[model samples]
Target: MSIVVSLAVAVAVLLLMPATATLRTRSPSVLPAFVSLPSAPQLRNRLMHRLLRRQARDSRRRRSLRLVDAMVCELRAGLAPRAALLAATSTLTEPLCPRAAAAAALGGDVASALRADAASLGLPLLIGVGVCWQVSESTGAGLASGLDQLLVTARADEEVRAEVAGQLAAPRATARLLAVLPLFGLMLGSSLGVSPLGWLLGSPGGWAVLAAGVGEIAVGLWWISRMVARIERDLMGHVKGAQPR
Candidate 1:
């Protein structure tokens, strides 16, 4: 009788705990309309990750872009690159922003800061602009045109990625559903005795079950990864003027 009561309590806890917890929790957040992004952001996430890998988020990407935009605006106002970038850092917190500002404070070049984080945008183009500025100090030949083109291309690529993320949202959510269904089954098993799960817990059969579980998890992960990589490739191809080779 005690054993049966314990099992009953365990089953009740298993079902009710998660339900009440979820119910009492804040409603899941939705993307702001300004962002109006895809619901399954994981499809755009680049890795099959564990704890720290997920946490090592680089919010600096947008900050770096903002810094560049500010630099461009200030330069168009006739400030030098060094001065413009220095002025822009007050509005940015990218890892490279402060260094750019300090270099300017020391009367050093802003091109160095641009070069340092230029790969985040396009290193070669930033360096090329630096070269142009140095060579044609007074003649504004083509520099403005190149900057305009670069910004246009960058914005277009960003839009393409947003669209791809939207397209892959359903697949990503499906993968997540597949991952959770087994857990739900496991919980149900603890109540109904339908799970031959003891065979999974105690012997050579246990090891076999563990191995099979591991393999299934790996396959599910690989499927998700392939789906994401395909989308990434397609997005890049669109940028590159060809289908993914």
Candidate 2:
């Protein structure tokens, strides 16, 4: 009779386990009930999107710089404004190049075309080129000199950005290391014959503790990201504002 009762109690506990887990998952006390971990697919998509945007941005910057250098060279070679733009753009594959060159060839508003291309292509650097073109056209200023100055300013801005990135690298690495340290702790615990995962998943109190830890990690990561973003934004804004109009 004693053995039968003990077996019945064990079975009852086993049956209640799933229900307990479900309840804990649905309403973890440390996080909002609606908050849940993102699925693998969601994470993959986000990472891909960020990579593509960075690639596109870098490509656009390179093309803009190349176009400016080419145009400056053509102008310094004694070409007319229209001929210089046509010659410079003819060497590049950027979608904006052909349209701006066509506008120059046809005696349309090349500045407007450049500006339109800059806006459509998400290339803010070209906006400065457009402005230089417009001012030179209206005031009979030296186009080559204007573009050369623009190139110098652009290179300076790039250097500042690179320096800022270098400065932030240490903080970024630190944040990443901090985020991974918990995993190291888990591994250490396992190596010592401690079932850390089992303990964390074994009871309602453990579930609450795990949820709190996850929430804290997420918050710390977000705070670091926000700080980095804010620093970059402010510095970039200051650089732009300090540039000559």
The top-ranked prediction according to lDDT is 2
How do the residues 91-129 of candidate 2 rate in per-residue lDDT, one tens digit apiece? 877555566778888889988888888888887767888
TM-score of each: 0.63, 0.73
TM-score of 2: 0.73
Clashes of 2: 0
Scored by CA lDDT, what does every candidate get? 0.55, 0.75
Q: Please estimate how well model 2 matches the true structure, expressed as its whole-model Cα lDDT.
A: 0.75
How much is 48 displaced in model 1, in angstroms? 9.4
TM-score between model 1 and native: 0.63
CA RMSD of all predictions: 12.5, 10.3
Worst 10 residues of 1 by lDDT: 30-39
In candidate 2, residue 102 scores what lDDT?
Answer: 80
The runs of at least 3 residues in candidate 2 whose Cα sits more than 4 Å from the true structure, single-residue gaps closed, are 1-35, 93-99, 105-107, 199-208, 233-245
Q: 143-218 in candidate 1: lDDT tens per residue?
A: 4455555566655656666677787778777887776565555656666666544554344554455456645765
